[model samples]
Target: MSDQLLQLLFTGLTLGSIYSLIALALVTTFKVTGILNLAQGEFVAIGALLAISLYATGIPMFAAFILAIILVAIMGGCLERAAIHPARRASGLTLIIITLGLSISLRGLALLIWGTDTYSLPAFSQGGPLIIGGAVLNPQSFWILGLAVITLSVLYAFLGLTYAGKAVKAAVINRTAARLVGINPNTISFWAFVGSGALGAAAGIFIAPVTMSTYDMGFMLAIKGFVAAVIGGLNNIGGAVLGGLLLGVLESYSAGLISSGLKDGLAIIILLVVLMVKPHGILGLLGERKI
Candidate 1:
């Protein structure tokens, strides 16, 4: 491939990794509690904001990241209890609308508290780009990709090996059955919300320097993440990762060969076609497992 093409691909992977993290969180929440969770992006923004603020106060970057994640995770659990718990048995459409409203409300509240200015973290990684075989890669790129892989691996281990993770899987598969088996679906759902929030927060903390944090960032991130989730197959964790990487790379190529203005349109077109052709997603077959 040409130099420009190679560079774009690398750039795309970086962006795609961010999308994958966000989409994985979205999928996890949906799988466990059946909520669309429009507020997930707000979780991202909050985490980014917290990290930046704490870093400004002289806290270490690593400590800031962990604190931001913890705060968002707590908020996620609180949101589940306050907003979604009562509506768990409500229709899916209702739950979706409620979350959408919650998202809007949070966006407004963020603006009220944080104002409209954009904020960034003190550089999490050092200066300069690393060149490899005619492609330029930044430290942030590795951070995004490595974190996504590590997070996904951790998530896989949690769900595949841990008793609590299995309980969540069982709850996702069928709440009634999980309850029958002595697992409290509500407890599983609480854990799901916390895990999902932590994922979103982590993404925010990592990308804060790359994209900067603004109250409105979450709105678009949510759309992109939702698109990734649909492309990957809703509630399919592996599919979510694949979809995120695919979309990120596709957008990068499109921007390289086509117009940057058309990137969002292209993403939407891809999502629409996927929904029409294979709503089950790229790895939809995996959903056949018991929860």
Candidate 2:
């Protein structure tokens, strides 16, 4: 591969890891509750902002990250109870609209609190870029990739081996059957929302050093995450991982080889093709188990 190509690959994979985290959170929320949460991205923005604020207040980075995640998770749980549970009987479209409303509300709230400022954090580690074949690789990229692998592995184990995880899967596949088997879908859904919040927040904080974090960042991030989930198969956990990586690579390559302005459009284009060609996602049609 050319030096430029190698560099793009590294950059793409790092970005893909962040997208994977967001995609996972979106998938988790959809599987547990049939809601397409447009507000999920807001959790990311909020979490990043909170962590940065906390860190600015002289708190350790580790403590700031943990506190932001926990607070966002709690907020997710509260929102599910306040807004989602009450509309359980609503149609899927209605539930989606509710999330959209929530998204707008959250964005407005964030604007009120944080204004239009953009914030970023220091890299988790202090080091210069690694050189290989005349391509540069940031040290923080390893942290991103390592976290992605660990998160995916932990989630895979949890869903496949643990009773609670099984219950979550059962709830995703068939809530009615899960209930008959003594599983509480409602409770599971609540916890899933909380988990999604933590996942989204972690993604936000991890990428903050690499990208600017603004109140409005959630809008585009949410769209990209949803597109990734759709392309990978919203019902398939593994597919989300694949989709995120694929999207990231495509974005990086397009930006490097073509025009940076057209890079974001790839998500919409790929999403359309995927929906038209294979609505079940890359793995969904293969009868992949929904994690």
lDDT, candidate 1, 1-291, per-residue tens: 687788898888888888888998898788777788899899888888878888888978888888889998998899889888899889999999988888888788889978999997755578798888878778788887788778778887998899998888777667678899899878888898898789988888878878879987887777788889888888577778778888999999998888899888887898899899988786765554222
What candidate 1 gets wrong by more than 4 Å, as runs, is 284-291
Error (Å) of candidate 2 at residue 252 is 0.7
RMSD values, in order shown: 2.0, 1.6
Instruction: Please report the TM-score between candidate 2 and the true structure.
Output: 0.95
Q: How accurate is candidate 2 locally (lDDT)?
A: 0.88
TM-score of each: 0.93, 0.95
lDDT of each: 0.83, 0.88
Tell me the deviation in Å of residue 11 in model 1.
1.4
Worst 10 residues of 1 by lDDT: 282-291
